[model samples]
Target chain A: MNKYLERLYNGLIKENPTFVLMLGMCPTLAVTSSAINGLGMGLSTTVVLVFSNLLISAFRKVIPDGVRMPAFIVVVASLVTVVQFIMQAYTPSLSDSLGVYIPLIVVNCIILGRAESYASKNPVLPSIFDGLGMGLGFTVGLTLIGLFRELLGAGQIFGFQVLSLSWFTPITIFVMAPGAFLVLACLVAVMNIVRKKMDAKGKPLAAPTGCITGDCAGCGMSATCTGKRTADHTVKTE
Target chain B: MKELLLIAIGSAIVNNVVLSQFLGICPFLGVSKKTETAAGMGGAVVFVITIASFVTALIYKFILANEYLLRKGIDLTYLQTIVFILVIAALVQFVEMFLKKSMPSLYQSLGVYLPLITTNCAVLGVALTNVTKEYNILESVVNGLATAVGFLIAIVLMAGLREKIEYNDIPKPFQGTAIVLVTACLMSIAFMGFSGMI
Candidate 1:
């Protein structure tokens, strides 16, 4: 496989950001109330992720080592603002539904985690692919959750009636706040089962390194989870 | 007075930052292993978010508002996200230094979590919420405090339950985060009842 393609595959499957790594739980759980909302949020995040990765990787040499976090943040924030404006200009309804989450993407751990651990070290093209792969993985994860919740909660999928209304009363709770948590739990449990099955076949899923704890400190992870090492870790202070 | 109380009650319980709104799940999940640590993190969040809310509100009202910026047909509203993130980063650093010098004991407990707070979405979320809702500084502070308190309540409760679940004989696939998430699901359901209170 081409190295670029490998990066894509890595993000989409082996180290799926949403499920396997669990990096951006805030957006993953929040905007997934409906299928369309989930898709919109995921695509918007993907745009930010791809462009930020490109810019960061392209400028990896010039960014001083000590201030990488803020640099990554500034780059990501600018990209998010661009995406925010585009979203507002083109898709007003989705913009209204997503609301504060667009700005909140600036703080998402996935973008920072990728910048610190991957893009900062890799070249521009591969970084872009990595971003695309991870973005698509996140999109798939969120969209599936949204579809399930929307189908159950509203007896429909993306506003189309999939389940007939007479028999299925639309498990309304599935679309509410609690529904997001429950759906995520079930999906994660299923992923665990698949991992176990794959493990039995002597082909185990790749265990993700760093950012496992979802802390900003974890974003600096290279080999081990720096945030998990309370006393031993010597982090670079800016 | 009644309105302020309602806002407090509404944000703190009816619309919890963690359980319902899902603003700070990263820290809510990460720092919630032990009950004691959870409480400490909650304290740090309350301090940072309350101050952030206050400061960001003032900036929005005074500095970032298009009326205040040049006032010559230049709308700087597009800079909101970038400005907010920078303000939060600088604010967290300043708070850490001030806490360390002025109150060593408080710093000792919250110092570790302070760096982590800069990336926590709840701080920025409250700020943006204040802006979108057009809240005055006072209302923003109250809402921010109430949201942080809500986060504290949810995280502490999650930690307590995780402690109990730690000893239980769980299924193989449901161990670790999956189980924790399941616990969160139930807690989320429990919190849903609070919606009727306000």
Candidate 2:
């Protein structure tokens, strides 16, 4: 139970898919123009992620290693189909708002990454929790960016008027491509600063290194201090 | 012919896949570092997107939306993502095999990027967007081609700028990706100038 909780917590903040790992930047930037849109995308992705992780974990041993990637993609695509249909039928507004992003979630590296890394190796329960946690983390990160952008860019939060329009001229750029980059950059900078402060006070920050480059062996920081110190020393000596 | 040209130009310049519509951003940022490589990637994307759009459109119109399928109460619109992915994956595999057999040099240049395009949201996005917009087959093809060209233009321009930035003295923290993103922001702002043109 404690281990499950630990994994969940780690995924939410320490190894957040969007902010910390930067796994799926396409949807992160593209769909986050408004808070509602961001939430919609985030939840839709979460549903797909959780179900795909569960199914993949259950069938991990059966899937041959050679064809695992294609297999994983098939599972993700099917799950994305389910979510897309449900959204289109029940939440047409969100479906429209999310646009092509909901379908693009099938290609999102985070879902495939989790399935390959955690779900394929871990037990079913832990894998499910991992998915939920990671999905929630991505949702929170996207929503935060969306909230910031919407509030400043359009003076609204989830279409509710949060600020008086007369007081400020909305920075329309925040709702644009440049705004996505600006918000993401600031979020990353802030995360880095927070991590630095945490490290200074003896609380170790979460260091998720297997994402993006997918070269855990080549990362220098992991070698010096993590749990695999003996292996790290051996590699260094060689 | 003029309308088709207008559609192409509109997609390519005014409503760019990357800057305006926010499609295919992964490759726009990921593969747009070197001008030569960007051009190669752009060519590959142009081929993939244009071809995939035509194929997917035909499938959606002929098979999925066929009267028989509708009578059976099976709206395959729900399966758009799955079907499109399968089609794309198969198409990419076929292309890979053809390239390996016919033009090894071109294959080698585009070898690594080919697999990456399988999961490119831009290709799938264009296909899905075409269906939603209810574009006729010819218009869909033109839109897909133009969107790819737009991506090519944006990435090539970005690559040139990044190449120039490499020679300049950039700041400490904003040296690599941070600086590139800042540059992209400025580029996007500049591209917004074209929004009013249409």
Candidate 3:
């Protein structure tokens, strides 16, 4: 596979951001009440991620090492602001349904994580691909979760009534806050099962870049991932 | 006063920073393995969020959203995200320096947490939410405090539950974050019960 394809494959399957890296848990659980919300959030994030990655990679030579983070934030914040405005104008309903989350994308860990680990070092083309791949992976993960919740919660998929209203009393809670947590949990567990089976079939999966085993100290983004979480961790060492 | 009380209760219990609003979830899941750390993170979040919200609100009202600027056709409100983030970063640094000089012991405890939260979406989220809700400074601070308290309650409960969960014979796939999330799912449902209170 070429470099671009490899990046796509890696993001979609090998190290899926939602399932494996679990980078941006806040938005993942928040706006995924409907399939449309998830898709919009995902695509908007993709646009921001790709542009930021592209810009950062192009300016890699000029950004001072000491101030790279702030510089990256400015670029990303600008992109996110543009995306938010576009959503508000073009897709007013999605903008409303997504609510404050559209603005909160300024701090989504995946964009920053990709910038820090990929875009800052690699060439421009690859960084863009990396952003695209990661963004799409997150989109798929969110859409799947939203579909399940919408199907079960409102007896509808994308506001179209799928489950017959006569019998399927929309679980209601599934559309609320709890359902987000439950659906993501079940999806991840199923992914885990699939991984185990794939391993048994001699098609081993790649481990996620971040520590899924709860070892933040060893992870690259430990400080931002969890604030001094390692400080109070019993298993951590100097 | 009644309105303030309603806002406090609504933000803390009914809306719930962690369980419902879904801000600060990375720490909610990451630091929640131990009750002690969870509470520490919660406390730090409260401290940071209240101060950040207060400062951001003042800036937005007086500087960014000033009618003087608006009359000049200068709508700097679009710079809200970038400016707020810069302010948060600078504010954390300023606080760290002040704490180290005037309150070393406090710094020792909180210094470790300051940098970690500079990029935390909750800090910026609360700031933006204040503007979106058109909350005054006092109201913003109250909302921030209540939101932090909600986070504290939820994380502490999750940590306590996780400690008990460690001993259970969990299924293979539901071992780590999967089970923790399931626990969170149930907790979210319980939190939903508070919706009627307001």
Candidate 4:
């Protein structure tokens, strides 16, 4: 595989930030009440991630080690504010629906995690692709979860009712908080089962254990995956 | 006072910071494997969140929200994300240093978890929520404390549950985080009973 495609595949399947790595669970569970909300949040985050990764990677050498974490955060927070203003102006309802979460994106582990782990180390293009890959992975993960919940919870997919009203009673719990956990847990378990089968066939999605043993070469957090290197953890060590 | 009490209850139980709002889940899942560590992490979160919220509230009320400051062409509201996150980071650092110097044992127990709180969405979420909800300084502080307490309650309860599950014969696939998450789902279902309690 091409290096760029590798980055994309790395984020999408090999080390999916959501399902495989479990990096950004907060937003994955929060804004995924419906398919549209999940898509909106995911795309918005992708925009932020792509740009932040690009900028952070470009300026990697310039940002001082002592204050790199603070610098990365300032960059991400500014990007989030810009995104928030644009969303508020054009997509008022979407903005309102995602409320507080837009700002909370500043704390979303995926962006900062990517910045610290991949973007800050790699070159500009690869970092950008990495961000796009991770963002897409997160988007797909959230959307799938949203699709499941919305279908069961509201008998709708992206506001279009699929199951006729008389056909079944929408399970209200599927749209609630518990449903988020249940769906995520089930999906992850399914993913594990699939991986087991894949491994039996001599294929593996990601390393069996985390980025441990340095097998995860391009991974951003490889330097201090063990959490012992406080200097590498930066600001939001999520 | 009654209103504050209601807000406290509302944040602490009715709309819990963890189960309901889904903030601060990384620490909720990561540090919750052991009961003692969970309690320590909860205490650290409570301390950091309460203080961070208080400081952010004061910054918002006095500097960001001031009409005089706005008239002078300084709009700090746009900087809330950067400001709030920087504040939380600094505050966590301060707490870590203080703990290490004055209470080494406590610091040793809660060492790595302290840094993680800087990124914990609960702290920043409570700070941002305080602003969005139009909470005054006092209300914001109360909300922060209450939210942290809510986090404390949920994580401690999870820790207790996880301890019990250690001995239970569980299926292979669900042995680790999957089973713990399913447990959390059940807990979330149970906590849902608190809806509308306020």
Which has the greatest TM-score?
3
CAPRI level of candidate 2: acceptable
Ranking by lDDT: 3, 1, 4, 2
Output candidate 3 Cα RMSD.
Answer: 2.9
- What is candidate 4's lDDT per residue for A74-176, written digit by digit as tens? 9998999999999999999999999999998887867877898778889999999999998999899888888989999999999999988897799999899
Chain B of candidate 4 vs. true chain B, TM: 0.94
TM-score, one value per model: 0.93, 0.88, 0.93, 0.91
Sorting all predicted structures by TM-score, with the top scorer first, yields 3, 1, 4, 2
Which ranking of candidates, highest DockQ first? 3, 1, 4, 2
CAPRI class assigned to model 4: medium
Interface RMSD of each: 2.7, 6.9, 2.6, 4.2
DockQ of each: 0.59, 0.29, 0.62, 0.54
Native-contact fraction for each model? 0.60, 0.38, 0.66, 0.56
In candidate 1, what are the lDDT values of residues B1-198, reduced to their tens digit? Answer: 787788789989998998889888877777788999999999999999999999998888777774746677667767889999989988988998899899999999888888778777899998898888887889989999999999999999999998898899998877776787778888889988988897
- The TM-scores that each candidate's chain B achieves against the reference are 0.95, 0.91, 0.95, 0.94
* lDDT tens per residue, model 2, B107-191: 8777656655776778888998888888889999999999999999999999999989989996554554566667777877888
Off by over 4 Å in 4: A207-238, B105-112
> Pairs clashing in candidate 2?
none
Q: Write the per-residue lDDT of candidate 2 for residues A13-110, one digit (tens) a residue.
A: 87887766766777888889999888888888888989999999999999998778778888999988888889989999889878778888887878
Q: What are the runs in model 3 whose C-alpha is more than 4 Å off?
A: A209-238
**Of candidates 4 and 2, the better by lDDT:** 4
lDDT accuracy of residue A206 in candidate 4: 62
Over 4 Å off, model 2? A189-238, B71-74
What's the true lDDT of residue B92 in model 4? Answer: 82
